[model samples]
Target: MTLAELTAAQRHRVIAGTFTDRVRATKSWDAAAPVAGWTARDVVRHLVEWFPGFLAGGAGIELPRGPGVDEDPVAAWQTHADAVQAVLDDPATPGRTFANPHIGELPLDQAVDRFYTTDVFMHTWDLARATGQDDRLDADYAELLVTGMEPMEELMRSSGQYGPRVPVPAGADAQTRLLGFIGRDPSWCPS
Candidate 1:
Protein backbone atom coordinates (compact mmCIF):
# COMPACT_ATOMS: atom_id res chain seq x y z
CA MET A 1 0.00 0.00 0.00
CA THR A 2 1.09 3.58 -0.56
CA LEU A 3 2.34 5.48 2.48
CA ALA A 4 -0.72 7.69 2.24
CA GLU A 5 -3.02 4.68 2.20
CA LEU A 6 -1.66 3.20 5.43
CA THR A 7 -3.74 3.30 8.58
CA ALA A 8 -2.55 5.77 11.22
CA ALA A 9 -0.86 3.08 13.26
CA GLN A 10 0.83 1.62 10.23
CA ARG A 11 1.94 5.02 9.01
CA HIS A 12 3.53 5.85 12.34
CA ARG A 13 5.29 2.52 12.33
CA VAL A 14 6.86 3.39 9.00
CA ILE A 15 7.65 7.09 9.57
CA ALA A 16 8.72 6.82 13.16
CA GLY A 17 10.76 3.73 12.35
CA THR A 18 12.86 5.81 9.96
CA PHE A 19 13.44 8.48 12.62
CA THR A 20 14.33 5.76 15.08
CA ASP A 21 16.81 4.36 12.60
CA ARG A 22 18.38 7.77 12.19
CA VAL A 23 18.47 8.15 15.96
CA ARG A 24 20.24 4.83 16.37
CA ALA A 25 22.73 5.69 13.68
CA THR A 26 23.52 9.13 15.07
CA LYS A 27 27.15 9.30 16.16
CA SER A 28 27.35 12.98 17.05
CA TRP A 29 24.42 14.38 18.86
CA ASP A 30 26.06 17.77 18.75
CA ALA A 31 26.63 17.78 15.04
CA ALA A 32 25.28 20.79 13.14
CA ALA A 33 22.06 20.05 11.31
CA PRO A 34 20.56 21.49 8.16
CA VAL A 35 18.11 23.60 10.12
CA ALA A 36 19.67 26.90 11.04
CA GLY A 37 21.07 26.79 14.57
CA TRP A 38 19.67 23.32 15.33
CA THR A 39 22.01 20.53 16.26
CA ALA A 40 21.40 16.87 15.58
CA ARG A 41 20.20 16.55 19.15
CA ASP A 42 17.89 19.49 18.56
CA VAL A 43 16.22 17.57 15.79
CA VAL A 44 15.29 14.89 18.29
CA ARG A 45 14.72 17.51 20.92
CA HIS A 46 12.14 19.24 18.76
CA LEU A 47 10.21 16.05 18.09
CA VAL A 48 10.26 14.69 21.62
CA GLU A 49 9.58 18.01 23.22
CA TRP A 50 6.74 19.30 21.10
CA PHE A 51 4.38 16.36 20.48
CA PRO A 52 3.59 15.27 24.01
CA GLY A 53 2.15 18.65 24.89
CA PHE A 54 0.19 18.77 21.67
CA LEU A 55 -1.14 15.28 22.28
CA ALA A 56 -1.98 16.04 25.88
CA GLY A 57 -3.71 19.28 25.08
CA GLY A 58 -5.67 17.83 22.21
CA ALA A 59 -6.39 14.26 23.28
CA GLY A 60 -5.68 14.19 27.00
CA ILE A 61 -2.99 11.60 26.34
CA GLU A 62 0.22 11.85 28.28
CA LEU A 63 3.26 10.27 26.78
CA PRO A 64 5.98 9.04 29.11
CA ARG A 65 9.02 11.17 29.64
CA GLY A 66 12.43 9.68 29.12
CA PRO A 67 16.06 10.73 29.28
CA GLY A 68 16.65 14.37 28.52
CA VAL A 69 17.90 15.09 25.03
CA ASP A 70 20.92 16.77 26.51
CA GLU A 71 21.82 13.70 28.46
CA ASP A 72 21.12 11.00 25.91
CA PRO A 73 19.47 11.75 22.60
CA VAL A 74 19.19 8.15 21.49
CA ALA A 75 17.50 7.03 24.69
CA ALA A 76 15.38 10.16 24.63
CA TRP A 77 14.13 9.41 21.14
CA GLN A 78 13.62 5.71 21.83
CA THR A 79 11.54 6.45 24.90
CA HIS A 80 9.51 9.12 23.17
CA ALA A 81 8.96 7.08 20.00
CA ASP A 82 8.04 3.98 21.96
CA ALA A 83 5.51 5.94 23.96
CA VAL A 84 3.94 7.36 20.80
CA GLN A 85 3.87 3.92 19.19
CA ALA A 86 2.29 2.44 22.27
CA VAL A 87 -0.44 5.03 22.12
CA LEU A 88 -1.13 4.20 18.49
CA ASP A 89 -1.08 0.51 19.27
CA ASP A 90 -3.51 0.81 22.14
CA PRO A 91 -6.86 -0.60 21.20
CA ALA A 92 -8.59 2.08 23.21
CA THR A 93 -6.90 4.99 21.48
CA PRO A 94 -8.15 4.64 17.93
CA GLY A 95 -11.59 5.99 18.75
CA ARG A 96 -10.41 8.77 21.03
CA THR A 97 -11.13 12.35 20.04
CA PHE A 98 -8.52 15.07 19.79
CA ALA A 99 -9.70 18.64 20.07
CA ASN A 100 -7.46 21.55 19.32
CA PRO A 101 -8.47 25.17 19.12
CA HIS A 102 -6.66 25.88 15.88
CA ILE A 103 -7.51 22.72 13.99
CA GLY A 104 -10.73 21.81 15.75
CA GLU A 105 -11.41 18.14 16.49
CA LEU A 106 -10.20 15.00 14.84
CA PRO A 107 -9.76 11.36 15.71
CA LEU A 108 -6.69 11.11 17.93
CA ASP A 109 -4.92 8.87 15.48
CA GLN A 110 -5.54 11.21 12.57
CA ALA A 111 -4.30 14.19 14.53
CA VAL A 112 -1.08 12.42 15.32
CA ASP A 113 -0.74 11.18 11.79
CA ARG A 114 -1.39 14.54 10.24
CA PHE A 115 0.76 16.75 12.44
CA TYR A 116 3.25 14.81 14.49
CA THR A 117 4.23 11.91 12.27
CA THR A 118 4.76 14.14 9.24
CA ASP A 119 7.05 16.36 11.29
CA VAL A 120 9.06 13.31 12.22
CA PHE A 121 9.28 12.29 8.60
CA MET A 122 10.74 15.64 7.57
CA HIS A 123 13.12 15.89 10.48
CA THR A 124 14.46 12.46 9.64
CA TRP A 125 16.34 14.10 6.83
CA ASP A 126 17.83 16.68 9.20
CA LEU A 127 19.13 14.05 11.55
CA ALA A 128 20.45 11.89 8.74
CA ARG A 129 22.11 14.80 7.01
CA ALA A 130 23.75 15.99 10.21
CA THR A 131 25.17 12.54 10.81
CA GLY A 132 26.47 12.04 7.29
CA GLN A 133 24.07 9.18 6.69
CA ASP A 134 21.79 8.49 3.76
CA ASP A 135 19.21 11.28 3.71
CA ARG A 136 16.86 10.01 1.02
CA LEU A 137 13.16 10.25 1.85
CA ASP A 138 10.34 8.29 0.21
CA ALA A 139 9.68 10.15 -3.01
CA ASP A 140 5.98 9.46 -3.24
CA TYR A 141 5.41 10.57 0.33
CA ALA A 142 7.46 13.70 -0.20
CA GLU A 143 5.45 14.62 -3.24
CA LEU A 144 2.24 13.98 -1.37
CA LEU A 145 3.24 16.30 1.46
CA VAL A 146 4.44 19.10 -0.79
CA THR A 147 1.27 18.97 -2.84
CA GLY A 148 -0.86 19.03 0.30
CA MET A 149 1.06 21.93 1.81
CA GLU A 150 1.28 24.10 -1.29
CA PRO A 151 -2.22 25.39 -0.80
CA MET A 152 -1.54 26.20 2.83
CA GLU A 153 1.70 28.00 2.09
CA GLU A 154 0.49 31.36 3.34
CA LEU A 155 -0.92 30.01 6.60
CA MET A 156 2.09 27.83 7.20
CA ARG A 157 4.48 30.67 6.47
CA SER A 158 2.58 32.96 8.81
CA SER A 159 2.65 30.38 11.57
CA GLY A 160 6.45 30.52 11.61
CA GLN A 161 6.55 26.76 11.79
CA TYR A 162 8.34 26.83 8.45
CA GLY A 163 10.81 29.24 6.99
CA PRO A 164 10.65 30.85 3.60
CA ARG A 165 10.60 28.38 0.77
CA VAL A 166 13.90 27.79 -0.99
CA PRO A 167 14.03 27.72 -4.74
CA VAL A 168 14.93 24.46 -6.47
CA PRO A 169 16.04 23.80 -10.02
CA ALA A 170 13.47 23.41 -12.76
CA GLY A 171 11.89 19.97 -12.64
CA ALA A 172 13.72 18.99 -9.47
CA ASP A 173 12.93 15.56 -8.05
CA ALA A 174 10.15 15.10 -5.52
CA GLN A 175 12.41 14.83 -2.50
CA THR A 176 14.38 17.90 -3.49
CA ARG A 177 11.23 19.87 -4.07
CA LEU A 178 9.94 18.75 -0.69
CA LEU A 179 13.10 19.85 1.04
CA GLY A 180 12.79 23.23 -0.58
CA PHE A 181 9.11 23.50 0.20
CA ILE A 182 9.84 22.89 3.86
CA GLY A 183 12.43 25.71 3.86
CA ARG A 184 15.45 23.50 3.70
CA ASP A 185 18.16 23.62 1.09
CA PRO A 186 18.25 20.27 -0.62
CA SER A 187 21.95 20.78 -1.15
CA TRP A 188 22.66 21.67 2.49
CA CYS A 189 25.50 19.88 4.21
CA PRO A 190 27.07 20.45 7.59
CA SER A 191 29.95 22.88 7.62
Candidate 2:
Protein backbone atom coordinates (compact mmCIF):
# COMPACT_ATOMS: atom_id res chain seq x y z
CA MET A 1 0.00 0.00 0.00
CA THR A 2 1.06 3.57 -0.50
CA LEU A 3 2.45 5.63 2.39
CA ALA A 4 -0.67 7.76 2.40
CA GLU A 5 -2.89 4.69 2.64
CA LEU A 6 -0.79 3.22 5.42
CA THR A 7 -0.69 6.46 7.33
CA ALA A 8 -4.43 6.94 6.78
CA ALA A 9 -5.23 3.61 8.37
CA GLN A 10 -2.87 4.34 11.21
CA ARG A 11 -4.56 7.68 11.67
CA HIS A 12 -7.99 6.04 11.87
CA ARG A 13 -6.73 3.62 14.48
CA VAL A 14 -5.22 6.42 16.51
CA ILE A 15 -8.41 8.49 16.33
CA ALA A 16 -10.53 5.49 17.23
CA GLY A 17 -8.14 4.53 20.00
CA THR A 18 -8.25 8.03 21.42
CA PHE A 19 -12.03 8.08 21.55
CA THR A 20 -12.08 4.65 23.14
CA ASP A 21 -9.48 5.57 25.72
CA ARG A 22 -11.22 8.78 26.67
CA VAL A 23 -14.65 7.16 26.86
CA ARG A 24 -13.19 4.43 29.05
CA ALA A 25 -11.43 6.89 31.30
CA THR A 26 -14.04 9.58 31.67
CA LYS A 27 -17.62 9.31 30.58
CA SER A 28 -17.89 13.10 30.89
CA TRP A 29 -15.76 15.78 32.43
CA ASP A 30 -15.34 19.49 32.55
CA ALA A 31 -12.37 21.46 31.20
CA ALA A 32 -8.90 20.00 31.82
CA ALA A 33 -7.46 23.24 33.14
CA PRO A 34 -9.12 26.43 34.33
CA VAL A 35 -11.30 28.64 32.12
CA ALA A 36 -8.18 30.65 31.24
CA GLY A 37 -6.56 27.70 29.48
CA TRP A 38 -7.43 24.60 27.50
CA THR A 39 -9.63 21.90 28.98
CA ALA A 40 -9.63 18.28 27.86
CA ARG A 41 -12.93 19.14 26.26
CA ASP A 42 -11.21 21.99 24.44
CA VAL A 43 -8.69 19.63 22.93
CA VAL A 44 -11.47 17.48 21.46
CA ARG A 45 -13.18 20.65 20.38
CA HIS A 46 -10.05 21.76 18.53
CA LEU A 47 -9.67 18.35 16.89
CA VAL A 48 -13.19 18.66 15.65
CA GLU A 49 -12.70 22.12 14.16
CA TRP A 50 -9.26 21.37 12.74
CA PHE A 51 -10.67 18.88 10.25
CA PRO A 52 -12.29 21.47 8.00
CA GLY A 53 -9.56 24.09 8.24
CA PHE A 54 -6.69 21.81 7.26
CA LEU A 55 -8.78 19.80 4.84
CA ALA A 56 -9.77 22.97 3.10
CA GLY A 57 -6.16 23.97 3.00
CA GLY A 58 -5.12 20.52 1.71
CA ALA A 59 -7.97 19.58 -0.63
CA GLY A 60 -8.42 23.11 -1.88
CA ILE A 61 -12.13 22.72 -1.24
CA GLU A 62 -13.89 25.64 0.34
CA LEU A 63 -16.79 25.74 2.72
CA PRO A 64 -19.24 28.60 2.93
CA ARG A 65 -17.13 30.98 4.92
CA GLY A 66 -19.05 31.37 8.12
CA PRO A 67 -18.54 33.65 11.09
CA GLY A 68 -15.21 33.54 12.91
CA VAL A 69 -16.29 30.47 14.91
CA ASP A 70 -19.30 29.21 16.73
CA GLU A 71 -19.80 30.44 20.22
CA ASP A 72 -21.08 27.11 21.46
CA PRO A 73 -17.97 24.95 21.38
CA VAL A 74 -19.78 21.62 21.46
CA ALA A 75 -21.97 22.31 18.47
CA ALA A 76 -19.06 23.69 16.48
CA TRP A 77 -17.05 20.53 16.95
CA GLN A 78 -19.86 18.13 16.04
CA THR A 79 -20.70 19.95 12.83
CA HIS A 80 -17.18 20.26 11.44
CA ALA A 81 -15.98 16.80 12.45
CA ASP A 82 -18.99 15.09 10.92
CA ALA A 83 -18.56 16.96 7.65
CA VAL A 84 -14.79 16.44 7.63
CA GLN A 85 -15.13 12.69 8.15
CA ALA A 86 -17.70 12.41 5.36
CA VAL A 87 -15.52 14.21 2.84
CA LEU A 88 -12.44 12.24 3.78
CA ASP A 89 -14.23 8.90 3.42
CA ASP A 90 -14.94 9.64 -0.23
CA PRO A 91 -11.80 8.71 -2.18
CA ALA A 92 -13.05 10.45 -5.28
CA THR A 93 -13.05 13.72 -3.41
CA PRO A 94 -9.88 15.53 -4.33
CA GLY A 95 -7.91 17.52 -1.76
CA ARG A 96 -6.72 20.90 -2.95
CA THR A 97 -3.27 22.42 -3.04
CA PHE A 98 -2.49 23.48 0.50
CA ALA A 99 0.25 25.78 1.66
CA ASN A 100 0.51 24.06 4.98
CA PRO A 101 2.05 25.54 8.10
CA HIS A 102 4.30 22.52 8.53
CA ILE A 103 4.65 20.23 5.53
CA GLY A 104 4.55 22.73 2.63
CA GLU A 105 2.53 21.75 -0.51
CA LEU A 106 1.23 18.59 1.15
CA PRO A 107 -0.53 16.39 -1.46
CA LEU A 108 -4.21 15.71 -0.92
CA ASP A 109 -3.94 12.10 0.19
CA GLN A 110 -0.87 12.74 2.34
CA ALA A 111 -2.46 15.85 3.79
CA VAL A 112 -5.65 13.94 4.46
CA ASP A 113 -4.11 11.39 6.79
CA ARG A 114 -1.23 13.52 7.97
CA PHE A 115 -3.45 16.13 9.56
CA TYR A 116 -6.02 13.68 10.86
CA THR A 117 -3.74 10.91 12.02
CA THR A 118 -1.03 13.11 13.40
CA ASP A 119 -3.76 14.75 15.43
CA VAL A 120 -4.70 11.26 16.52
CA PHE A 121 -1.19 10.60 17.73
CA MET A 122 -0.53 14.05 19.14
CA HIS A 123 -3.88 14.46 20.80
CA THR A 124 -3.26 11.17 22.53
CA TRP A 125 -0.46 13.07 24.18
CA ASP A 126 -2.87 15.89 24.95
CA LEU A 127 -5.46 13.56 26.43
CA ALA A 128 -2.76 11.86 28.43
CA ARG A 129 -1.78 15.20 29.87
CA ALA A 130 -5.34 16.46 30.31
CA THR A 131 -6.46 13.48 32.33
CA GLY A 132 -3.17 12.33 33.76
CA GLN A 133 -3.27 9.13 31.73
CA ASP A 134 0.44 8.58 31.99
CA ASP A 135 1.26 5.50 29.95
CA ARG A 136 3.40 6.16 26.88
CA LEU A 137 1.98 5.85 23.36
CA ASP A 138 2.21 2.57 21.45
CA ALA A 139 5.44 1.90 19.53
CA ASP A 140 3.91 1.55 16.09
CA TYR A 141 2.76 5.18 16.13
CA ALA A 142 6.22 6.31 17.11
CA GLU A 143 7.76 4.26 14.31
CA LEU A 144 5.57 5.91 11.71
CA LEU A 145 6.69 9.32 12.91
CA VAL A 146 10.35 8.33 13.15
CA THR A 147 10.48 6.87 9.65
CA GLY A 148 8.13 9.55 8.41
CA MET A 149 10.41 12.34 9.58
CA GLU A 150 13.70 10.78 8.42
CA PRO A 151 12.77 11.07 4.76
CA MET A 152 11.64 14.70 5.17
CA GLU A 153 14.79 15.92 6.88
CA GLU A 154 14.63 19.22 5.04
CA LEU A 155 11.08 19.86 6.19
CA MET A 156 11.83 18.73 9.71
CA ARG A 157 14.28 21.59 9.92
CA SER A 158 11.41 24.07 9.71
CA SER A 159 10.02 25.16 13.06
CA GLY A 160 6.45 24.39 12.06
CA GLN A 161 7.26 20.93 10.79
CA TYR A 162 7.83 17.65 12.66
CA GLY A 163 6.78 19.26 15.97
CA PRO A 164 8.27 21.47 18.63
CA ARG A 165 11.66 21.33 20.28
CA VAL A 166 10.60 20.06 23.68
CA PRO A 167 13.38 18.05 25.34
CA VAL A 168 12.82 14.36 25.90
CA PRO A 169 13.96 12.63 29.06
CA ALA A 170 17.48 11.38 28.44
CA GLY A 171 16.71 7.75 29.23
CA ALA A 172 13.30 7.74 27.58
CA ASP A 173 12.58 5.46 24.63
CA ALA A 174 11.63 6.40 21.09
CA GLN A 175 7.95 7.03 21.71
CA THR A 176 8.63 9.48 24.49
CA ARG A 177 11.23 11.24 22.46
CA LEU A 178 8.94 11.38 19.46
CA LEU A 179 6.17 12.89 21.54
CA GLY A 180 8.59 15.42 22.91
CA PHE A 181 9.80 16.26 19.43
CA ILE A 182 6.27 16.96 18.32
CA GLY A 183 5.49 19.80 20.74
CA ARG A 184 4.18 17.64 23.54
CA ASP A 185 5.74 17.52 26.94
CA PRO A 186 5.52 13.89 28.06
CA SER A 187 5.48 15.30 31.55
CA TRP A 188 2.94 18.02 30.67
CA CYS A 189 0.31 18.92 33.18
CA PRO A 190 -1.99 21.80 34.12
CA SER A 191 0.17 24.32 35.89
Best candidate (score: lDDT): 1
Task: Say which candidate scores most in TM-score.
Answer: 1
lDDT string, candidate 2, 1-191, tens digits = 42334545444644645654663474334536322366767766656665666666655665443223334434444455445555556665444455676567855655766667666566666655666665466676676776676566556657453444568767777777776666566666566
- After superposing candidate 1, which stretches have Cα over 4 Å from the reference? none
Off by over 4 Å in 2: 1-10, 20-36, 62-80, 94-107, 150-164
Could you tell me the TM-score of candidate 2?
Answer: 0.65
Give each model a TM-score: 0.98, 0.65
- Spell out the clash pairs found in candidate 2: 32-39, 32-40, 59-95, 59-96, 60-96
State residue 47's C-alpha deviation in candidate 1, in Å: 0.3
Q: What's the lDDT for residue 110 in model 2? A: 59
After TM-score superposition, the amount by which residue 102's alpha carbon in candidate 2 deviates from its true location, in angstroms, is: 7.3
